[model samples]
Target chain A: SQELEQSPQSLIVQEGKNLTINCTSSKTLYGLYWYKQKYGEGLIFLMMLQKGGEEKSHEKITAKLDEKKQQSSLHITASQPSHAGIYLCGADPYGQNFVFGPGTRLSVLP
Target chain B: DTAVSQTPKYLVTQMGNDKSIKCEQNLGHDTMYWYKQDSKKFLKIMFSYNNKELIINETVPNRFSPKSPDKAHLNLHINSLELGDSAVYFCASSLGPSNQPQHFGDGTRLSIL
Candidate 1:
């Protein structure tokens, strides 16, 4: 079975500051997904990285998959209150199911 | 329009009772999944159906059953629920079982008293 570990179980940062959250998997990942969930809402897909060394960005958020495909990081620039939520990383190891990490709670204070 | 939707955003019921949660997706996806988020915010896959066929059934107990009458709808029924069964259940859908990013519903918050 594959398991995922996320660094900085929770974080508090000032708005307009930059922060990064890391996700590491016990096994090589076939696909890595980044999602953000508001306090009581569903998850909103952010981005997906498939190949090793792949990096993608949307607006002010960027996600990168390491060359080893065992670790991924999500970086947010100029964070806003809207970015405050639970950030979760999910990994697909066997393409059969997804294993999610214990989410990193982000609090951006204005 | 909502891509994925679940009925009864919140559910509160007594233990030992049976309850059903309904999900529907209009994304024209072939695969649908049910996930449970615990108090720790750890999301776990409970069941997955591809094209109305059961594809993945995790270590979930037999008391939890998932039914997919069509590719766009998946319903979950829990029998004799316990206190530990209380959690936020989310429904998701994708183009296929793997490689595609899943779209999640607003989730149903189930509370067992």
Candidate 2:
């Protein structure tokens, strides 16, 4: 069984639309991270959450960690075309042996 | 300078051969990891090293070995390579085993013929 699971394997939205990607875990998330990967490119770190009910934002992207530590969500506000990529969620419950989810592919069209 | 670098961005070789992929991270991180992404894009961890010491080794076969010369370099050597070895290998480095973000090399695309 996958320790981390993401919803909506793929999604598409028009530019300036808001979208959310959800990640669920089977165990407590010691540290949860979000990364974005373009085709044929390496992953780029977006954000990380260590405390429950923690919320972090960068530009138009914001991520929230639930108090339960089993679910996390990434919210994109007024997305742009450049926001399109594979969104991956990784969690290391014990702060070791991090595992990544299958990823949610996002496509923001112009 | 490349933070995390891997040589031979692409590799194509036949089965039952021996090959090596070299990875070096200039970030001076203490922890390094090897991840394999299969054709289906499912990424899995194969091994992790902390300060030249093997910290995590998955259920990988014996033919696959990871060597860390120092805190900045980790190389992978594969022997008797099987067809199943065809995939993308990624080298990533982080500050430590905690919540630090990992910096990954572009990746080495290996194709087994």
Candidate 3:
């Protein structure tokens, strides 16, 4: 069975600080997606990475797929209170169904 | 209007009871899916339908049934629910099965007593 692991199961960052979260997969990723989930709400799509070494940024959040396509990282620069939420990485190993990782809870202190 | 919507934001029922959650999407997408989020925040896909036809069915138990009457609606029904059935169920839709971004609905939190 394939597995996806995320580092720093939880994080706390002061407002205006920077933070990074990593997601590693046991198999090569066909597609990698980043999503944010607010408390009591559905997940919001952040970005998608398909090719190796591909990177995307929306606002202050940036996501990068490693050259091996088995690991990805999400970086937040100048984090704010509004950026606090649960970050999840979903990977498709076979190009069909997605396998999601246990999310990393992020807290941005005001 | 919401792109994706689910009813019964919270559901609490006995272990032997049966329950249903309704989902709808207005994005005119061809694929819809049902996902379960466990207590540890691990999300897994249970079922998916494309154009009102069953496409992807995961290793879900037989007690759970998914009905897709149309391209825009997918409903989940669980029979004789057990304690393990308690979790957050999310409904999502995508333009197609592969390489498409999914839009999720606010999950229905199910609790079995």
Candidate 4:
């Protein structure tokens, strides 16, 4: 079985500041997904990384998968209140099912 | 139009009661999945169906059953729910069974009293 561990279970950052959340997997990941979920709402897919050393960016957010494929990081630049939510990392290690981390709660104070 | 949608945004019932959640996706996907998010915000896969066929069934109890009438719809029915069943259930779909990014629904919050 594969498990994912996310660092900084919860974070509080000032608006316009940059922050990074890390996700580490117990096994090499075949695919890594980043999603954002507002309180009481469904998750919004942010980005997906498949190949090792792959990096993708959308607006102010960027995600990178390490060359080892065992760790990934999501970095947000000039964050806003809208970025405050639960950021979750999910990985498919066996190609059969997806395993998710405990999630990182981001609170961006204005 | 919403890519993925779920009915009854919230459900509250007594223990031992049975309930169902319906999910529909309009993205023309071939795979659908059901996930439960516990209070700790840990999301776990409960069931997955690809093209109306069961593909993955995690260690979920038999009391929870997932039905996919077609590739676009997946419904979950829980029997004799217990207090531990209180959580947010989300429905998601992808283009295939493996290595594809998934689109998710708003999720149904279930509360068992």
Task: Tell me, by TM-score, which candidate is best.
Answer: 1
Candidate DockQ scores, in order: 0.93, 0.79, 0.86, 0.90
CA shift of B96, model 1, Å:
0.4
Model 1, A1-110: lDDT tens digits are 89999999999999999999999999999999999999999999999999999999999999999999999999999999989999999987785578789999999999
Q: Candidate 2: which stretches are off by over 4 Å? A: none
Worst 10 residues of 1 chain A by lDDT: A91-100
Interface RMSD of each: 0.6, 0.9, 0.9, 0.7
Better of 1 and 3 by DockQ: 1
Tens digits of per-residue lDDT, candidate 1, B1-113, equal: 99999998999999999999999999999999999999988999999999999999999999999999989899999999999999999999999889889999999999999
Instruction: Return the clash pairs for model 2, or none.
Output: none
Worst 10 residues of 1 chain B by lDDT: B93-102
- TM-scores for candidates 1 onward, in order: 0.99, 0.97, 0.97, 0.98
Report the Cα lDDT for residue B24, model 4. Answer: 98
Show the colliding residue pairs in model 3. none
Sort the predicted structures by TM-score, highest score first: 1, 4, 3, 2
Give me the runs in candidate 3 sitting further than 4 Å from their true place: none
Give the per-residue lDDT of model 2 (tens digit) for B52-105. Answer: 999989889999999998899999999998999999999999998767888889
Q: What are the per-model C-alpha RMSD values against the true structure?
A: 0.7, 1.3, 1.1, 0.8
Docking class of 2: medium
